[model samples]
Target: MTKEENEKRLAYLKSIVARLPEKPGSYQFYDDEHTIIYVGKAKSLKSRVSSYFHTEVDRFKTKVLVSKIHDISYTVVNTEEDALLLENSLIKKYNPRYNVLLKDGKTYPSICITNEPFPRIFKTRTINKKWGTYYGPYSHAASMYAVLDLINKLYKPRTCRQPMTKEGVKAGKYQTCLEYHIKNCLGPCVARQSFEDYQKNIAQAREILKGNTRQILRDMRAEMEQLAEELRFEEAEEVKRKYLLIDSFVSKSEVVSHTIDNVDVFSITNDEKVAYVNYIHVSNGSINQSFTFEYKKRLNETEQELLQLGIIEMRERFNSHSKEIVVPFEPDMELENVVFTVPQRGDKKTLLDLSLMNGKQYKFDRLKQAEKLNPEQKQVRLMKELQEKLGLPKLPYQIECFDNSNISGTDAVAACVVFKSMKPSKKDYKKYNIKTVVGPDDYASMKEVVHRRYSRLLEEEQPLPDLIIADGGKGQMGVIREVIQDELNLDIPIAGLAKNDRHRTNELLYGFPPMSVQLKTDSELFHVLTQIQDEVHRFAITFHREKRSKRALESELDSIKGIGPKTRDGLLNALKSVKKISEANLDTLTDLIGAAKAQIVYDYFHPENTTGES
Candidate 1:
């Protein structure tokens, strides 16, 4: 393709990529003549496929791969596993010229039952037809081994490779190994434990491998009870140990129960050219699997695409059957009966966020692996973190915070403070006098002030801020939302900063009805929020105090026993203020208000000179 053609092609690719669904699926990259060059899977098809043109990818191979692209296609799947299997199958079928081979990628071990007469149960990377049963293609060998170890501990399955036969045992040709000496095995080689009994144990072990450990627990409990009733203390004790082992393992694995029995959570985080995706699997409210991996965006794929692909890849790689997938976005894929959710503020949101954090951490670590620290790195890092943390679509280059203050139903006022790039924007700070509400009605005062502020901005056609923060709880936040959204018809994001009884910022509230968002108090975002809240509160209080002071200054002279309003006005008009009046000479005051009242006013204004506290 020519340079101009490539530019046009990139733009066209971007448009098509933008329409990719966020669901678990696989995608294909094609050259100019529509020859398939690469095949990939994604949890979000749109996010993944669209990312190719995100930036000028640094890797040479990626640059070539993206440059060769002309058209793209995708296959939507119900789960991540389906995407992975599809990606594998499609890659093999077409032999995409530019596709990168995942080396020994599917070599992870699985628990296998050998086809021998006395089947040996163990973890193996090889899948042979001679293996009686294969339990998993576990994402990690440790996971498969953990299950195998648990099975051996509970059921005492023989670990020996010695082939057992009735004739060999009858002829005394087989002897018990060290496993029997250590009581880890039941000596099936010597026939101390019959094949029927050992086979029964193996059957139960198979159930655990199949994720039906619950049935085994119930059966073990009943056996324990029966043994205890029969006065078989040793057998009952053994059953009790196995039951507790399974129960503890199960209980420790639970994550959340708000959804259903099975769920897969996918989250994505990315840098300029690379993306990291994290996957979490929850079964029976327990986290059964979690992983984070990297993806190189050949065409500048977005975080959305990377995360979607990660979900598909992780699910497919782990062979997960979860139908309900939790994500931070709607991948826009139509998978039958599979639900994708974007939770706001609940347990599900928490889990999704946890996965997001993992992705972010993984990306951070990867960046650090090659990171060269510069002066602006921290600032850039903070801005990006804030963008992710607040779920803001854009970086918070401009933030506006508001507060309302009243002094004993007097001097009703509000203040708006500006923060630009996490620093105070003093020149943009604004103060307002309460105009619409009577008494100490903070809600009305806030509504009036916000309406006036934004109304002027709208009339002037000024840019709205990236974020608006209200220094109050839901009630006050509702008023701001009403003014900013309902009245102005603007689509600005707003959050509430609430204080505890001690007047300290303790929670950040967001969403329609406003739910408290969890945050670590020591985090930089929390600190920034606290700073914004404090600045607005301080500004409002300062303005309120100044107004009250002015009123008090004007009224001090009027409080004199002999001074009336007319006299006080005359003195104030001449002297400008009580402070000025205090500095005025006796002759000046007497000239402004008559001698007797002027003396009273002068005495009140200069109480210190009159022997009383001023």
Candidate 2:
């Protein structure tokens, strides 16, 4: 915004803030279009709103937000808790641009138990309150199916859609379908099963859904024993089957310990633009529900604020009433009856770690999905990572790596490979022969190459690479810095790839003294670094081999007095190898080349024959 316009907006916001009551409330900021762009809850509306206009408001995003605001509105509340609830509801309703965006779970399926006389249980994507109690909007369909399967095996609830009232059942309005014939149902539509018995089974299933399996297991075991004592072997065997099913299902759940019951565990992690929160609801020592979700950040929200919002959302969604909550850190808000524990050790700590792992995994999966959609995002992310790791002021969009290669200093050569956006740019790759430096003096060769490369770039006013990497350890980095910084007085960031005993890239070295920056060997960042190292090495080696081969060929042919370029080309074209040219007879050589050049070549190879003729 223009300076005058910005000052005008600040003055308008300050006047509104002066009039705001000092009570706990939620405030909304409107843009020039009169649309709400931000909503926040505060203990004192006047104090919070006034702080935004203070001169000390230095955060760039916050300044931008304040500059956009054309108006302010607020709602007075009785307490901070009420303001929090009001803020949450308003955020959900309006979804302001500057509020944390919660990804909705309406698309996920929930296990709903119908509210009919014979409540049918099934998976559904919709939630209707008149349709009975909904257990979950399950993120993983497989886990939901597992629970449904267990319920079907144990309770044998009716799966039909028929609405059977008491009068309808008595008048035989509904007929038994194939479910009854297949013994999947007890023909409840025809009243073959007592109402009381069906209701009891549904009650048991509800308990199981609530993750109260231990009590159900005990009751089933007791009933099984009673049936056996009464000489009802078939009924007892059926009860045994159900008891075993519940037991197996419970065993599969992650159980922290029986001592720790009815607790909620939460973990939070974030990237530049998004925050991920993982929730695990433990009931009766078993993990009843596990979910990981992300919040798209609009402002620079802290981990504490996101975690508190996540705790409220998860608790409300799961209807958790656990008195104890385990978190990685203490949140900013407080609940009347709830206690937040930041466990340092033991099972609770392990549970916290498990939640953190899920959060990180969810973040990773989301990143992968985004990168797949826009492949360039992956490159940009890697470049940012490289920049942050090397402490460079800017993203290393263009990186150049240098390497020198020689075999006993015969054909000394250096190669500089260019990488633009973390990929090799073969067009920009350069090869240089050692001129001022002789022998296999790697340091001197590198100095000459570095000096020549950048001096020309500067002279031509071309863009220099954001980062320059030496394909060696600290010593090589020092050499490049001297040429680039000390001599040329250019301020290019330089780094080096340090190798281990097995001749593998181990870590990156950076800075003046060249401190090691360790990178995971399996990470994509490390792969990119190694790729740059390998490309420079490969280019230098290939160039060295070509130059050496050309020198060897020149020494053999060009050394002869009469073997001009044309005559040598003619001889090489006919005889592919130098050995073949040496072994050829005069007649063959004369036929391939002219008689004059052929005689010189033959005499050179057959010195003994020339001596005898003389």
Candidate 3:
């Protein structure tokens, strides 16, 4: 905008801000298009809105946001807590561009115990508040199914759609269906099970859904014992089966502590673009519910802010009245009755760790899925990661790694392996036979190869590799830098791959003085670095072996006077070995080569006798 226009816009914004009240509220920022671009909650609406237009608003994104604002709107609230809730609601409603986006808008399935004459329990994605009590919006369907399966086994609730009332059962308006015959239901509609008994089972199922299984287990055990005392063996055996089922279910749950009931545990993991939060709700010593979700960052929100928003959103969604929340760190917001915990050790710490693991796993799985769709995304990410780690000027699009191979100075060879876009470029691979450097002088060999590789690229007017890697440790890294930077006067970044005592790729060394670059052993960056080292090593070793083999062949057969390359090749092909050629008689050699070549060969190996004289 022009200077006068900018002044006018700022003045207009300041005038609107001046009229704002200093009460807790949610505010929305509108852009030139008159659309809500950002939504935020603050304790003082006037102060928060005014702060955005201040000269010291240094955050680049916030500054850009201020520039785009053509109008402002807000809703005053009685307290900060109300402001937080209102902010969340407005963000969900309008989905402003500058608001943290809830990425996983998935409506997960929940176990609903229908509020019918005979409550039917099943999994549902849609919630109807009149439908008895909902156990969860289970993030994992298998968990919800397990709960329903246990409920089915224990209660044998009616699956029929017909409303079962006591009057209908007495009037014979409903009949027992196949579910009754299959022993899946107790036929509450047909009056086979009393209303009171069915209601009692429903109550027990509710307790189990709430993860209050101890009371239900004790009741089932007592009922089973009573049946046994009455000599009702079949009924007692059935109750025993249910009692054991509930017991097994309880044993499988992650039991924290009986004292840590109704507490919420949360942990967060984030990158530049998104943040993930994992929530675990504990009830009666068991993890009753767990979920991991992501937030698409807008305006570069801090992890604390994202986490605070997540906490409020989750609590409201789950209808949780959890007074105590276990967090990795205290979030930037507060709830009236809630106490935040950052535990050092104990059950809460374990829960916090578990939540962190889940959040990280969720982020990893999401990245994996995205990479599977576009495989190049992973390569680009790894390249950027390496670039960032090394503080390189650019992405390591083309990496060249050098390795030397020899058997105690014999057949010395060096190989250069090139990786373009983090993949091996086999055609670009170069092999160098040791010319200037004799013996197992690895440093000299690396220096020679590095000088040769880049000098040729410069002479040919071709692009130099973004990075050059040495297959040996610190000594080799110094040799490369001296050759590439000092002698050749090129500015390529050089790194070294160091092997452990076991000759396994162990660490990466880079920069002057060569500090070890810390890389996780299992990470892709480590894998790719190791791949380059191994490839170069393999290429160098194979070249050395081939050179040695040719020399060995020349020593045996090339020394023969009449045996040219073709003659020697023919003999080797026919006889399969030098030993076999030596063992062959003149007649056999004549058939393979000519009689004259055969005589020379026979005479060379069998100098004791003249071949034709016999």
**Which lDDT values do the candidates have, in the order given?**
0.77, 0.89, 0.88
What's the true lDDT of residue 332 in model 2?
A: 73
Clashes of 3: 0
Candidate 2: count the clashes: 0
Model 2 agreement with the true structure over 385-415: per-residue lDDT tens digits: 9998988999999999999999887689999
Deviation from native of the Cα of residue 423 in model 1, angstroms: 27
- Give me the candidate number with maximum TM-score: 3
**Global lDDT for candidate 2?**
0.89
- What is residue 134's positional error in candidate 2, in angstroms? 2.3
Which residue segments of model 2 deviate by more than 4 Å?
Answer: 1-38, 44-79, 155-201, 433-439, 458-461, 542-614
lDDT of 1 by residue, 473-554 (tens): 8988888899888888988888888888998888888888898887877886789788888888899998988899878866
Identify the superior model by TM-score, candidate 1 or candidate 3.
3
lDDT: the better of candidates 2 and 3: 2
- TM-score (all chains, Cα) for each model: 0.48, 0.81, 0.90
The true-versus-predicted C-alpha distance at residue 160 of model 2, in Å, is: 4.4
> What lDDT would candidate 1 get against the real structure?
0.77
Between prediction 1 and prediction 3, which has the larger lDDT? Answer: 3
